[model samples]
Target: MDPKTASNLSFILNKPHDVEFKSRDLPTLSDPHDVLVAINYTGICGSDVHYWTHGAIGHYVVKEPMVLGHESAGTIVEVGSAVTTLRPGDRVALEPGYPCRRCGPCLSGKYNLCPEMRFAATPPYHGTLTGFWVSPADFCYKLPESVTLQEGALVEPLAVAVHIVRQAVVTPGQSVVVMGAGPVGLLCAAVARAFGASTVVSVDIVESKLAFAKSFCSTHTYSSQRIPAPENASNIRALAPNLAGGADVVIDASGAEPSIQTSLHVVRTGGTYVQGGMGRDEITFPIMAMCLKEVTAKGSFRYGSGDYKLAVELVASGRVDVRKLISGVVDFEDAEQAFEKVKEGEVIKILIAGPNEKKE
Candidate 1:
């Protein structure tokens, strides 16, 4: 390829803690239903930083240089011949993952479980932290007039929370307890409230995060204690006694073993438990207690089916405001600094500006 033929500038992760800016060849529509987007903003996810510093996530290893972002929004500069919902100059959020539509899970509307899913920023798949990207037109959600591209980039995490809340089956007049105060956790609490949960409690080990949660979405916050898991569960129940036995739904977004243990114990008998955080591959589970209480335990992966679309509607309607979760934004050239800040635990959700636009 000639040097002049390349115009897609991207931040490539060459190895652990090593990233370089390079102009990749402009991406093309791989299928008749695909669309090309000019990336405008990209958010830093924990998984993104992990890949940048570890060169791999689980079995997904970086054997070659790969682009470095997935949470993103961009302008659709070109659409495939079969695409109809989008056209040139449309602003939309990139879902960043596409599964094989030929699988049983895909047919069942659970494509997130498809074994052949090609997720961006994972091994061998280029991410969206670039000037241009290509994705299926169906995965690209157009931003309404009420939403901004900065907010559009947040649809990914919001979709994760939506899926978690959906798995938990959160309902009106119920109490929901969310473990962890990160972006996803906070969003989970918010979505639960939007789903009609009467009381939302956010639990975290950090007092500051809990404070932020109280102001952001949760009706209450619990700072973890050094006591036993059962006692912690009891104390959490004391914070919100609206539910009889305990919280109607318990979600673990922290992935910490202690949180997991307490989350299982915190759910009322016959209540639901959803694991949404990324922890170790294995942990000491309280299977017996869960069995005795008849707790329904479910694992939440990435968003699925109507998750992204619902997330967009939630944000657009102001039911779940993600703007408060944004800690800061950095320019595209300083994308490395954004990664460093997140690695150092200095920011919540920081976005990197694309070359096509300045700070929004």
Candidate 2:
């Protein structure tokens, strides 16, 4: 297959806010286990915005023109010879990353940590933010009839939340605090509740986002901007009286240093603390306090095996309402506006459609 033969409408990041829609040749499946999909909807992610603005995320730099977007859902248009689980016309969510299955991490069922992961829209890999894309059949989960393509696109982010909740081992009657009311944070709160957490508190700087968090599944919402930061432990206790009383688990989805610091201060002794968001490579952690409380702190990257499947189940079983999180949908041509909305932090999730988009 020649690179010139692929047909795609890519949002090329030439400059900030400058998106180019190019028509290239269609992509072909190289491996017998691969499948070709006609993408219908792609969700604008924060990482996509980061790449658009800074042109780099951590060590992954966009040195050349690259397609943006990873959260996507589509219908199978073709399948390779060895693929038996999926067929043409199957509606599915494309798990954007494909890891080296022969690696140690893959054998240990932690493929998300595989060092040779080819994640879409991340760098050196084209993304699914186009009309058609190719991926391994195993990475694509078939969506149930009840789930729409939009909901299928949401499965990508929901999978991250699912993985975090599983890592935290959230159980019934446990009190959970989610610092950050972004899309992932809201999804985490919803999944935690589905996993039987008795109480879920979402803290964010935006009151509107906090209000939106309540609509999904959070038991309580707090605006940290409204509550000034404390100068000492006494002030911290006063600010988060309910949480200072002790939380069984704290998930930092904001990636902000302050939120990470407060998570340690508010979590109960022996509680679990999980970092679900990415921020600076290094920060001043409360190591002494974490040690004193015997808190278990862990970092959650992208979703691992079975996370995407569970994410689809959560939506299909009506356990999590993903539609409420969708702020707006834009045509494929207006995809740039979707990114702008995300930059403005005015929407929870934005869905971009293809040329043949059908109303749902």
Name the best candidate (by lDDT).
Answer: 1
For model 1, the superposed segments whose C-alpha errors exceed 4 Å read 1-7
Q: Using TM-score as the measure, which candidate wins? A: 1
TM-score per model over all chains: 0.97, 0.93
What is the C-alpha lDDT profile of model 2 across 1-360, one tens digit per residue? 212443466667765656698875778789999998888899998999998888888898887788888999998888999999999889999999999999999999999999999999988888877878889999999999999998999999999999999999999988888999999999999999999987888888888898888877988776674342333222434444455567888899999888888788778889999999888888886787799999999889999989999999999999999999888899888888999899999889999986456555
lDDT of each: 0.91, 0.86
The weakest ten consecutive residues by lDDT in model 2 span: 228-237
lDDT of 1 by residue, 214-244 (tens): 9988999999999999889889988856854
Q: What is the C-alpha RMSD of each candidate to the true structure, in Å?
A: 2.2, 3.0
Residue pairs with clashing backbones, model 2: 5-25, 5-26, 6-24, 6-25, 6-26, 7-24, 7-25, 7-26
